[model samples]
Target: MRLTVRHTTTYRYAPPRRAVVQSHRLTPSVFEGQQTIWWNISVPGAWTGATFRDGAGDRIETVSMLGPVEEVLVEVTGEVETQDLAGVLRGHRETVPPTAYLRTTRATHPDTGLRELSADALAGADGDPLDRAHRLSRAVAEAIAYVPGETHAHTSAAEALSLGKGVCQDHAHALIGAAIAADMPARYVTGYLFVGDEPMGEASHAWAEIHVPELGWVGFDPANRCCPDARYIRLGSGHDAQLAAPIRGLAQGVGEERLDVSVDVAEAAQSQQQ
Candidate 1:
């Protein structure tokens, strides 16, 4: 299946700033089950400074903003081709070795509540790795309410687990923590999900992928309680949300400055030709 994606982000500052520097990881790459046909990014008040690939092989770009800038906007548009590999990705594969996904700065220290999802909980389960992981994901989803503003990006998986409230990011992290504790290799995936009959909303989405020895990396979106389909356009993979964040940046001057962010993910309408 083919999909077209449009992601737009805007940053507004409380007070006008002198300059700004930002890093972006909004580009998608072709993987075992997906292919990128075309992708491009545009920044209204920023200029591309440099581009490189990060440790996880994600495409990264740096942008510089001019002085007295109060707002910055970035837009990404792309199309990808995807195939359903549910059957092939179901079982484990021996060829793919198990490896720990490197931790990110924010996802490091577990919050007080998140510690309960340690290896012990996973090992205690009486089932195969795949079955265990599926059960764990479902449990996390059912346990947590998809509440906004209840948790921030830095909230730990343990905290989310205990609070029983969080967005998709928290669910993904909780599932990852549980999988890792279970002695399974799991990674964080950031992307956009087609809401289908649900209401359109702000921002992209987040999910988790576990590695089965033979199946390689298989995705699970606990927030949606299903595997990713053609509507999903993967952006990057890492240990947690911070690593796959669409944007990160620093500035030279700072004094009582407030940060504001807005994100939009929409599906492109079919063209007349199509």
Candidate 2:
């Protein structure tokens, strides 16, 4: 499958700022399951800075805008060819150890409820690690309902589980928390999902990746109740949604920031995989 993506993010300030700096993880992952056909990122009037590959093997780039800048825009356009690997991440180079992901962030810290949930989900179920992971994903899906606008960016996994409603971010965090409770190393993934039937929408997508002995990193989307496949385009990843954010930066001056974002992911004309 081939996918084309267009993403634009704009920031407006009530009071113009003197300077702005941003770090981006907007590039697609290079792995056996996916190939980048063409990609570009642009920020008008901004000077491009250092570029390097992070420990997770995601490309990181920086940009700076100096002025009484009131508005800044970041645009990304790309095409990628992807194949279904049953959600198994293969041939992706990374220096970070799997154990590093075991560390919990504010967004994914498991509470008492989450610990119990994990225990109950795996209780008396004798199977390999893969089976256990599937069971945990199913349990999370049953616990949390995918309801947009029910939660915000700072909502933690415990809160989402207690509320029983959240979007994909919450689902991913909750699954990560549960997986860690089960003694598995899990991390958050930020990416795009191609909704083939409908017109493009404003939101991007997220999922969770767990490390198994047999499989290095396997993706699971509890909100959709399935493993990521060709329809999904893999991007950068981190311990939580905030850390894994595609864009992060700060402005020098005090300016009330207003943000607008639009994203479109669609099937390309040529299909590269069956």
Best by TM-score: 2
lDDT of each: 0.70, 0.91
Per-residue lDDT tens digits of candidate 1, residues 101-172? Answer: 634335533443444544434556765666776776777787777888899978888778788998898888
* Candidate 1 global TM-score: 0.81
Cα lDDT tens digits for candidate 2, 127-162: 688888988999999999988889999999999999
lDDT of 1: 0.70
The residue ranges of model 1 lying beyond 4 angstroms of the native Cα positions read 87-98, 102-127, 200-203, 255-274
Candidate 1's clash total is 11
Q: Compute each candidate's TM-score over C-alphas.
A: 0.81, 0.96
Q: Which stretches of candidate 2 lie over 4 Å from their true place?
A: 198-203, 270-274
For every candidate in turn, the CA RMSD to the true structure comes to 4.1, 2.6
- Which prediction has the highest lDDT against the true structure? 2
